[model samples]
Target chain A: MTVQISDTARPAAAGTSSGRSLRNLTYRPEAGALIGTLGVFVFFAIFGGTHFLASAGTAAWLNVAAELGIIALPVGLLMIAGELDLSVGSVLAASSMTMAIVSGYWGAPMILGIVLALGVGVTAGALNGLIVTRTNVPSFVVTLATLFGMAGLTLGLSRVITGTTSVALNPDPGSKAVFGTLIAGQFEVAILWWIVVALGVGWMLQMTKYGNWILAVGGDKESARAAGIPTNRLKIALYTGSGFGAALVGVIQTILYNGAQVANGQSFVFNSIIAVVVGGVLLTGGYGSVVGIVFGTLTFAIVNQGIYYTGWNSDWASFILGVLILAAVLMNNTFRRLALSHAPRSGKKA
Target chain B: MTQPLLRLTDVGKSFVGTNALEDISLEVHAGQVLCLLGDNGAGKSTLIKILSGFHAPTSGTIEVDGQPVVFKSPRDVSAYGIATVHQFGGTFQLMSVGRSFFVGVEPTKGWGPFKRFDKGLAGEIAVREMQSLGITRVTDGKRLVGSLSGGERQALAIARAVYFGANILILDEPTAALGVKEATHVLRIIMQARAKGVAVIFVTHNVLHAMMVGDHFAVLIHGRKADDFHKGERTREQITDLMAGGEAMADLEAELAALEASAGSTGRS
Candidate 1:
């Protein structure tokens, strides 16, 4: 006789009913970022010229932070999804080129150029996602390949069409204020864009179904899939978000300086990942906060620009940054372990 | 009656030209617990892979409710109200309890871009589902799965399946490495599932447990069916003998007699 199976399709029995609260935070990375931001501010204000504490100085560093923060947020989300995007730099270059070709060369409407730039970024991200998912390759290898390929393509294509490495952008007065204007009408409008992006993406990550899925996939992909999560889709979306962020930064660069260059937006790759980690996200995934990443961005920017204020050898800036990444990461790891160790029990509702 | 909820007719699987399961047939009915017994590598894994839709049998027909059907992917098996709760009870360790419970199928609020996780509703559902399984009390309802015990983890997984509307539950050695206390907790949950009128397929090597709780016991020998018995049809000794090799015992008797004769004549001893 054949084996007969019954339709035992019952709802998954209720899950862990333990009511545990969030674990203790003896040393919060959040606090560290706050303290670090202020510490650097104080160091620069007291040691450097009186101009260091001026609004313009604050504006300059904040602007720098705003640009980097926008990219870091999406990169942080991607890291949370257990993936990486080395192609972000290339995406920036490609998006800027798309905008330059459309608006500056072809004389297309600024809106179309903007949409096309975003579209190019999305397409690049989708391609990266597809290659990674279909080939079952590590995202590092996949995105790195895209990184070089996109960079080469951007340089080759731009040189072919423009006969130069840079594109000059001159937006209308209305577009100029929106696409290029900064705070107090002098800082890069990109700074405001970074804020808007930070808020929007922050909300998406902290308050949406997508955020939960991202965390699940990052924490444990197999479990996520068993739980019915579309993990691959979540990863793809994260990469896309990163590409979008990078692309937006490209547009801002174009508007802020009224020019686009292939060499621009290069430091963002490592710097954003650094911001994510410094912000309290573990490179291994499944942890971190948008607020933390924002603080990380500020910490990074202040240290970067603050050194200039202190009149320290600007070349030593690189050395100082290397130390900060190490120091911040170590501190964050220690605090993380403490929090997790003290974290509420498994049976307790959180 | 209605071609049991799931039917496996002469299912076989092979790996790299080696047979894993051969001529295996099994069936489970609603409100029934089928205990699958086998030695390690008795083709239990092969049979499970086929049943769980992780792999297809080289030759077999899987009939659902009297109708032959094919599952192209795990998603296909899920559509037939079948779910496999692996031994480890795969749950996101990094996510909150409420998040893990309603992971891929979270309750949503608002519409469009305004759409968001209904954390409150998800919490309510998680609590309701847990309580239904007799876990009745959870204070914060926000703990991570990593914080739960091994037994509690299993309970949560079962609850997730039951709450998600799975009718057929295939548990793979649910209490394999568990302590006595933890094993009992799992057994209690199994009984809870049966009480819910759900068909449970309990795969384990624990004979005492099989004899104690299994409504039907089916012995699998080397990926082939050796015998099928109702709960009271066979004693534990008989089941153990059959599992360890009834044929080998007969061969051993002849060999022992021959050896005894040789020893006496040779006088070496």
Candidate 2:
């Protein structure tokens, strides 16, 4: 009986051997994303020439990565918990407009604008959570509705209040230093915020009990609930977290660029998901890591920004993004298969 | 001699106008296995759900330790030391064994917001408990539950319940999907749980499997208790006949023989 059971269960067990060794490196959840990052980096570094490796060139993509990473980390968590938030783009635009109108146009305190802008995001996110949990509608549809709704609201409000779709904000020096300033004259301060978000989210997903709950909920909601895990509450919290993330990015972009535009953030909705997928987080959920997302963000940023340095037509950016996303997913799938196939040489039979 | 850990008196359940269970009376005692036997659609599921607190009995009373209790939900029943391991072991496939073992009631270290899952303690306890259940192959707590065999998963689930202070373990068709060998392992786990003084409600239709570990038996047929007996009071044939609605099978066998005889005549002609 033991032998028969082992024979049946061995294939699944083969790749999941828990010993720490060189062979086990292939089985690390982030292994695929890491390889993809390195592969993309080396490809771009060769084609993008000396300037691409230069500080100014590096900062261009790093800045983009930083903003996207902030949103992608929480988005990744949502995906891992088996949901999607498509309203992040609108949340960004809405928050940006809120800050601009409050602080930039009305001359209110910068802190008040910041707080209100984030408040808009929190409200939108909480609504998203409430609707998703209460109505049993798929989050994809719910967030999609919010996406269009917020976009319209941001555009209409900005037009009515500021008399234009654009509003300018010249933040106080202290606020600029913290939220928008460029470090070393090139790197956006947002990069630091990105790292902090990554670390904090990483700790939450890997070390906390909440992380376990997220994984459980994503893995199998019925089983999780049967085991007495509060699957509904966990999901709502994750949705809200994703909302807060998008809003934070909106605030950062508004401060850094010194203006807000109603139409500026649509690309982020898909881009953050791209970064997350490239980071080796499964779209089906129940699997992923923050480190993988960071790497994915970097990969995406390079592919996005490297085109300018390569002197290619910017028109091909979307085309290349499509190709890169496909290639990254394929690569991740292969690596996952390899990692889950079987352990090498040091054979510990099940 | 002692008060049964759980007692259901004249329990009945109906879902929307359809009766699922009727007049089910049973008692389970610590250190004993009470096997619930029935064929498909025989109200075994409804009875187990009521017992496990997934469904409330529409009539009669459930007494825990001789005191009547109402279980509003599975969590409420679980609070009374009753844990039900479903058919597939009710485990998360993607999660690590340690995580799955301590899932809902995880051990935490630290204070307030800073408190986190104690992975080391969880892993150690999971491995130790599983090993105690004779699942020695699960050496690494980091192993995914998906990789464990059917029998091993059952053992893990049972061990988790035992470790979490589950005094009343209700196993729902645990060996139904397992192979012969795997079934043996599960049977052993049931006996082990019994030995540890846990009152077990083993639910299965397989007479041999039930006979292997059952001290008390209750057979449900068409939502009603057909027979309730001690282990030695009923023979295998008599129990099997009871499950088939007593003499209904004999009538069917005679009909089948007549049909066969007609077919044979037709072929000869």
Candidate 3:
């Protein structure tokens, strides 16, 4: 009897080992994101005409994607760890205003202004982490509170310090070259920064011990705690990383534009989330990938910019985005179900 | 007559005004399967909690290899090579098998500034451990743990504990939800662990499963040790009656007999 049972199990295990990579693709976490990216690129490449295929047209979407990708990557990480940071928008605005007021209005050194701006983001993020971990409050609520609170602080402080909501900046040549200058006078240098952030974050999530802890925490917090993982600390660090990412984007925009406004970053609040979800991340947490988030950012950017090249009606951009979100989520749901139900095919029922 | 792997003497725990457990004493040596039997609300979970280091005893002492030690946390207990596997294997369902196996203590390779988790090593080890536990269907450690059957998950948890050098294994109703075949597989794995010299604490409400592998048995009833004996000292019916709470079994039998007699006469009429 035991021999029969063992014999029956062997073929199934061996079956999955051979020629299964193609079948396995349907179960991969980034499968939906990959498909969505390709589908949208094809959609835009055809309807967007010759100009959309040009280098400048490509840079248009890439620039938007680069900025949003930086914020989306960490936000994706936060989401995978089972938390949400609704305050990235506020962090961005606050950081932008801080840099402008410090260097543009107060005439401080450019480096000092940059450091202080990033510091504001880290502080806001750490505060979000501390409040969410130390108390029973959900991260969504805590970050929402931070979002409004930081927005008020930035707006009020900008008005008080510069006597206006907007501040103009004349960045030092060095700072401009690293953070603001365009490549070949076409693409923002932020693209390079975005690539670096993605590589680092990807390494952290895929090849590090902490990545395992993050997934375990998101999968089941109680079990992760029982396994002796420092759940709270991991969550705090993820939130802080996201804070830094948002602030980096703020600094990039402030330098690139040569000015900052109190209301410059509010669009990022929903845009970053849209990019993350459209990339195939689970909104509730525990199943996502850096590759998927990147693809998601690109998909959002292509749709956002490609519509402008179509020259139909810019008003249709939001409509397409709304349909895209529903489609991506539904696609992700189908793949996740495939993943969960993919048990080995033994003779007996599992 | 070597020292028992784990010994509990006069261990008691209190919560507010109620004693969850009282003066519970038990001992098990390496290579032994000690089955803890009890009814619902019989302090079985409390005892398991105290043993697993989730709760500090309010009184008495727990000794390991003859040295009394206090376990203020699960980490402290794990350091003593005491591991617990709850129902459904206490596993992360969404994580891959290799990843779940090494959640807290991941294996790494390469030099500093380039250190990375050794995915191949982790997967190989996880797969080898599961195969050793007779889980032949799970050949790929990259498979998500959620994809494993209930029996396979339990085997994975046991394999993990053994791989991590657990001297004593505390399983909380490991076979409660398993079918006959799967339950038998888990029982076989438990025996395999016993053969390898790891002390096993098998907690269950099922009397038959307790008899199959249990070398020694202890029954808890209402925060107290009601019985303790070696194998063959009791019959299956006697064990079941005790687990159902002593006199309730006889009362239930008599009530059933009376109801049958009345129904038979009414049906004939």
TM-score of chain A of 2: 0.91
Best-fitting candidate, scored by DockQ: 3
Candidate closer to the true structure by TM-score (higher is better), 2 or 3: 3
Ranking by TM-score: 3, 2, 1
Residue A151 Cα positional deviation in candidate 3, in Å, after optimal superposition: 1.1
Instruction: Compose the digit string of candidate 1's lDDT tens values, residues A246-299.
Output: 898888788677778887788888888878887788787876667678778887
Q: Residue B28 of candidate 3: its Cα lDDT?
A: 89
lDDT of 1 by residue, B1-269 (tens): 54587778888887887888877777888878889988787877777777777888888788877789887777778778887877877777656668878878888899998898887777667767776776644433455666556776687788888887788888888888788887887888888888887778888888877776688888988888999988899999899888878778779888988899899988866
DockQ-based CAPRI category assigned to the predicted complex of candidate 3: acceptable
lDDT of 3 at A241: 91
Q: At residue A338, give the lDDT of candidate 2.
A: 58
User: Largest lDDT belongs to which candidate?
Assistant: 3
Runs of candidate 1 with Cα error greater than 4 angstroms are A1-53, A105-109, A330-350, B1-3, B136-138, B208-212, B232-269
Give the RMSD in angstroms, all C-alphas superposed, for model 1.
10.3
Candidate No. with top TM-score: 3
The clash number for model 1 is: 53
Candidate 2 C-alpha lDDT tens digits along A9-123: 2211222225667655555566777677777767777888878777787788888988898899898999988899999999999999999999999999999999999999888
